[model samples]
Target: MKIKSAEFARGVTGNDYSTQDNLPQIAFLGRSNAGKSSVINSLTGRKNLVHSSKTPGKTIEANFFCINNLFYLLDFPGYGFAMRGVQERNKMVKRIFWYLEFTNARPKVIFLIIDAKVGLTDLDLEMLEIIKQNNHKVVIVANKVDKLPQTKRKDKILSIVSQAKGLEVLEYSAKTHEGKENIFKIIEDLVK
Candidate 1:
C-alpha cells in the first residue's frame, strides 16, 4: 500500500469523466468540509496532492488522481453544503450522481468520509443508502478524530457507527496520521 508515485490526472465536472483506461477507481465522498482532501493527502503522504480548502464548497469538481500507476483515486465534490446557488448546486449534484450511477469506470470501492466530531448527518445516511442501492463496496472513514477529546472519542465513534448499519468504520486523523496506513491497505486490496 505504499504509494511510490502519485499524480493528478484530471478535474471533471458537468457530464464529463476522466479519460477512460479502465483502471480500478476508489472514490472518496462526503459532506462539504468533511475533510475528504485532508484524508487523501494524509493517506498518500502527499501533503498537497489534494487541496484542503479553508472555504467550504470550494471543491466543485471531481478530481482524478493516478495512484502508484496502479489505480485511480477519485475525489468527489462534497455533498450537502448550502454555500452554493441553486443552479450551481444542481449541476454539482447531477455531476456527482452521474459519475456514481452512470459512469463506465465504476469505483471498486467508495470511501465515505465523515467528520468524526460532527458524527453522522442525515445526508451521509442518504449517501450510505445510495452506495447500498448501487451495490458498491464502501468503507466509512470518520476523519478529524484529532479534534475529539479522549473522553468523548468512544461515544463519538459509537454515534457514527450507529448510523453506518454495520459497514466498516475507520477512525482517522489527518493531522495525526492515524489510520492512514489502514486506509491505504484497503485501497490497495480493492484495486489489486
Candidate 2:
C-alpha cells in the first residue's frame, strides 16, 4: 500500500478506547520482542514511524497509527514477557484480551507475528485461540525470515500451516523488506 501519510493517532488503555472514530483497522499481535513495532515501521515504509526499543515489552499502550488517512494500524502491547512484574503482565494480557474479545472496533484482520527462527510458542497458540474465539480472521506473519537460511523457509512455513490447520501465513523481513508487499496486498483487499 502506498503510504501517502502515516501519523500517530493515539494510545489506548483500559476499556475506554471508544474515543477512536470508526475506521478499518489492522492489528499486529505478538509476544514481547517479536517485533510488532518494527513490522509496522517496515509496512509503512518509514524507518522511525513507530519507535522500536531494544528492551522487551516496552510498548505499554495499544497504539494507533493512521495509514493513508483511510485505515488504522494498531500496535497492540506485546505479551508474554518475563521482565515485567506479574501484576503488570496480567494487566497487559487482560487489556489485549478485552480489546480482542469485547471491543466494538474489531480489526479487519489480526496479523499474529511469529519469530521465524524461534517458531511458535504456547503463548502464540493462546493468542491464536483468542482471535479464533472472537471469530476474527487472522493472518500469521512469520517475521525475521532473513535470519533463517533460505532452505528452511518452506519448512518453517509448512510447520506453521500444519499447526494452524490451514491458516494464511506470510513471511516478512523488516530488515530486508522481503514479502512486505504481500502483507500490504492482504490489508488492501480486506480494507476494500
Candidate 3:
C-alpha cells in the first residue's frame, strides 16, 4: 500500500471513549523506547509523524493516526517502563487490557514491537499472551534491527520467532527502512 498521506487523528486515554468511525485499525504495541513510534513514522513515510520519546513512559495515551485515508494506525502507550510506580504501572496495564479486550472495534492487526538487540524480554511475552487471550491478530516485530549485522539478522529473527508461541514474526529497522515492505504487506493482508 502506498502511503499517500499519514496524519495524527487523535489521542485516546481510556477505553470508555469511542473509536474513529469503526475503521479497520492496526495498533502498535511495545515496551517504552522499543521503537514503536519510529516504526509508525517509517511505515507512513512521514518522518516525525509520531512523537518518539527519549524518556520512557512519556506517552501515557493511545494515539490514533490516519493513513492515506484507508485505515487507522493506533499508537498505544508503551509498557514495561521502570520509572513508573506500581500504581502507574498497573494503570498502564489496565489501559492496555481495556483497549485490547473491552474495545468493540478491535484492531485488525497488532504490531508488537521489540528491541532487536535485547531480543524477546519477559514483558514482551506477557504482552503476547494478553494478545492471544483477547484473540487479537498479532505480528511480532523485532525493531531496531539496523543495529545488528546482516548475517545475524536472520538468526535473531529466527530466535525471536521460536520464542514466540503463535504470532507471525517480522524484523524491521525503522532507522534504515529495512523490512518496511514486509511489515506493510502483512498489514495490507490483514486490512484487506
**Candidate 3: clashing pairs of residues:** none
* Superior candidate under lDDT, 1 versus 2: 2
Q: Which stretches of candidate 2 lie over 4 Å from their true place?
A: none
Q: Give the 10-residue window scoring lowest on summed lDDT in candidate 2.
A: 14-23
RMSD of 1: 1.3
Best of the two (2, 3) by lDDT: 2
Residues 1-192 of candidate 2: C-alpha lDDT, one tens digit per residue? 778999999988868655346779899999988899999999999999888889998888899999887899999889998678888888888999998899888888999988888778899999889899999999988899999887988898788778777788888898898988899899999887
Candidate lDDT values, in order: 0.84, 0.88, 0.84
Model 1, span 1-192: residue lDDT tens: 777998999888666664667788889999999999888888788999998898889777789888888888888888887768777766776677777787777788899999998877887887777778888899999999989999999998997888788999999998899998888788767777
How does candidate 1 fare on TM-score?
Answer: 0.94
Which residues of candidate 1, in runs, are more than 4 Å off? Answer: none
Better of 1 and 3 by TM-score: 1
In model 3, the Cα lDDT at residue 106 comes to 80
1 or 2: which has the higher TM-score? Answer: 2
Show where candidate 3 strays beyond 4 Å.
Answer: none
How much is the lDDT of residue 109 in candidate 3?
A: 87
Work out the TM-score per prediction.
0.94, 0.96, 0.93
TM-score of 2: 0.96
